[model samples]
Target chain A: MNARARLLVFALGALLLGGAYMAALSQLAPLGRGASAYADILNRVCVRERHITDVVTAVNFDYRGFDTLGEEFIMFTAVMGAVLLLRRGKDEVQAPQEDELTSRRGRRRSDAVALAGVVFTAVLLLFGSYVITHGQLTPGGGFQGGVIASTALWLVYLSGSYKVMRQVGPKPLVEAAEALGAAGYALVGLIGLFQGAAFLQNTLPPGSIGSPFSGGTVPLIDIAVGLEVSGGFVLLLLTFMEEVLEIRLH
Target chain B: MLNIFCYSIAAWVLLIGLYGVVTSRNLIHLVLCLSVMETSTYVLLTLIGYRVGGTAPVFADIPVGTKAVDPVVQALMLTDVVVEATVMALLLALAVQAHKRTGSLDPHDLRALQG
Candidate 1:
């Protein structure tokens, strides 16, 4: 058999083996469809007593909040690492002349592309704000919204040049926002401790459930986390793009 | 019905991502493929939590709600999206830097530190 066919056959065999392994594991499950107590809890309890919204938010900011905190830290670390590793070395910065890299050749975008970019960036900014603000009430929340907001800058980058990206993404501004966002995230956890609850406890009033401000510390945490993430990702991407572009100063 | 659609789409997204990873020659494309792969997991998790035609899991909708999706999955996916973006950003940056020094987008040519 030819190399390609051999590879395909090997892959198919592996997939079948994996499926069999998973099926075997499935047989090990308890012989019940659902938990008896959980079903009882679902059926016997009144809706208010069940308190689904509060339960969710509580779990979010409390039970698994440490995981959320760690996620924010991961973003922070990734961005910082990117900046440190790809930053222009002093030698590269001082080099007399560097060869220009190949990218897109002479393809200048039409004005319509530029206009669409501007419109899309605006829509992303507004949508991100909406997502963050209405996080408690909707599926989209702070982190998702924040990434969306930050990626809007890439739209700007694609529209114009590195200069436009740099103008909006100065190192100091992004760094400060990132730092503040982290501090804010930590403070949310601390608030629970201050209120005699465990760390990252959902201590704040849950408020009226459907209100924009109902999720208590969750919304605040979401916004803080969003800001930090957006700032971080933008910095990381731009730093890399600039390195690739290998801009040389006169 | 929506759940089945969600599941099918999730599978499709994952397959498309795998295809990208397998076929891509450019470093940027590989990084983007990884992002797409991560996104498929997001879709799968979110769909698993979804109740068909369910309202948002808030008090306003809870009164008339038949079932609610899992908020934990939503929160988890939200965090994952941020993490993915950050990681993708870093990967793209590294790819750019590698290109600058060695001058190529193809991964096969990036053997700069080989001793």
Candidate 2:
């Protein structure tokens, strides 16, 4: 259709949407005691008496921990597959040197940025550890913390070169960490089985509600997840930047 | 009405993604669009399952007052987000390889891989 027709159609659609939203709002019960009554009921019957964070922890680590395991593996395999697919052949020429190493257009980083990146990497490392350790009690968790950790290398890469990234981002070390993380996750489930509980079931003592180590298997799993996620994301990004972005080391 | 809102948003996302996949010459754009579509559906699904004015599932502090929102959907979304992220990363990697092999980012140029 012509542009005018398209504009008319868009306007009509917006009008219809506005009308529908108004109708829905009219149907919705007014916000008052009735609307919040559910919250009051929960407070009196359940939440006011029990600790909400503990239950969230249990659900995340125990009840549905198996799913988290699978999620971690998904990340792990993606990184592995990316690396495998993107590896350069032995005879392939090393990417020729570029002048602007710090360009955001791709992975190219300037020398000055590379120097500053080392400092940023240290910050990310500390922040990531803090997130993973406090995951059980805070809004941040292993997965989020792991990504933050992995992103530390981007600065390192930007500041200097892939050499810097490789030195600190050692693939062998990352691989070992990934493997251990996976094993730790599995071991947690095995412990549950050995205790005669369901697989991935929380058998460890929950400790006190607000304590750092209070969430039993949740904190342990969080640590494992943190490692796996960080390793996986870094690996994936490295593979892509190396292969697709074609950032040369020399 | 809420269902309609959720479904419409889901449809809009899917259609926009479909358009991007079909019309975009760049492989990376296609993957990005696909992620956008996936995110839209996730939001729709979460909204469909949400209890209006419902709180998160967990009775950590209360004896037993509020009915918990569906933990199943929240848990599933967590898994879904991770899976989608993995898939997108892999797709981007493949797109890179395709670019390297063909010296082009257009999907129309990638015929060697096809039977």
Candidate 3:
């Protein structure tokens, strides 16, 4: 169908869908008044039970850890698919990747900008590590910190070059780290199984509340997730970058 | 009345995203429209989990018995976000393949699937 006709059709269907959606919305509790009894109990108990100051992390990495395992694999598989799809075919050459703009224009990069980028890269790396480690105590965790840390790779690329980014995050090393991260999570859960408890059960010392090591395996899982997520994203960035640079060679 | 306004905003954003998806010509634009649609869920989920006088569910600095919003939905929101990102990446990869094979990003140009 043509664009105009398709939009017209969409409008008619949307009206009905919107009506049904609004009806469903009306049934949900009002904003700021949702009395979720289960969450209330969970929030109240996570501190005493799991020593997790961040109740959300407790839910993600503890109470609902099994689901999180499945979630992690979904990401791993999807990223793997992306890598497969974006890989260079047999016909593609093994030439070095260079910035077409800089090479063609022959312009020099600014020293000040390069220095600032490097500084920012270091700062981001530090902050990301802090976030990942303090997941059980603070609002940030693996998912958030991992993405932030992965940004460091691009910062290095911007300041120096793509080759430097690749050097900073070597492909085989990153891929192995991603695999290890994925495996680490499962292995961490196996600690419980080996102890005759359920899989992913929190069996370690809960430690004193409010401390960094208080949440036992929760923080451990967060570190593994941090590794996997950052490694996966860096791999994605590398794949796309390679594709872009290779295409420019033509 | 105020409650209706917040939920209405979420609903409207969802509709807009859906509209964008149907009208999108390019595959990348369609992928972005999907992201926009996923954003509406974040809004709706946060709204559903909010409490009138409650704070974040953390107890790091605060004492026990303090009122807090639902952490369950927030945890689920993280799941939602991860799923959305991975799906978007997969879709973009598909878009790259489609462009390479068909030499066109426009969905309308390629109506029939040969493979």
Best by DockQ: 3
Over the stretch A1-250, how does candidate 3's per-residue lDDT look in tens digits? Answer: 7778998999899899899988998888877887988998998889999989999889999999999998999989988999999887665664554555233235666899799999999999999999988999989888888888888998888887766777899999989978988999999999899989999999999999878888989989999998988898888888887776655323
Residues A16-81, model 1: lDDT tens digits: 654564454344322222123332333223224422243343344445778889888888888887
Summarize candidate 2's per-residue lDDT along A121-235 as a digit string, tens digits.
Answer: 8999999988877765554567767878888877777666665566778777887787887778888888789999888877787666556777667888888888887877777
Stretches of candidate 1 exceeding 4 Å from the true structure: A1-13, A20-59, A94-124, A155-165, A246-250, B1-25, B50-59, B62-65, B101-115
TM-score of each: 0.73, 0.75, 0.95
- The positional error of residue A69 in candidate 3, measured at the CA in angstroms, is 1.1
Candidate 2: regions farther than 4 A off: A1-57, A90-119, A244-250, B1-3, B55-70, B112-115
Worst 10 residues of 3 chain A by lDDT: A96-105
Among these predicted structures, which one has the highest TM-score? 3
lDDT of 3: 0.86
Candidate 1 lDDT tens digits, B42-89: 876665555545444444444533454555666577667667776877
Identify the candidate with maximal lDDT.
3
lDDT of 2 at A154: 75
Ranking by DockQ: 3, 1, 2
Each prediction's DockQ?
Answer: 0.32, 0.26, 0.82
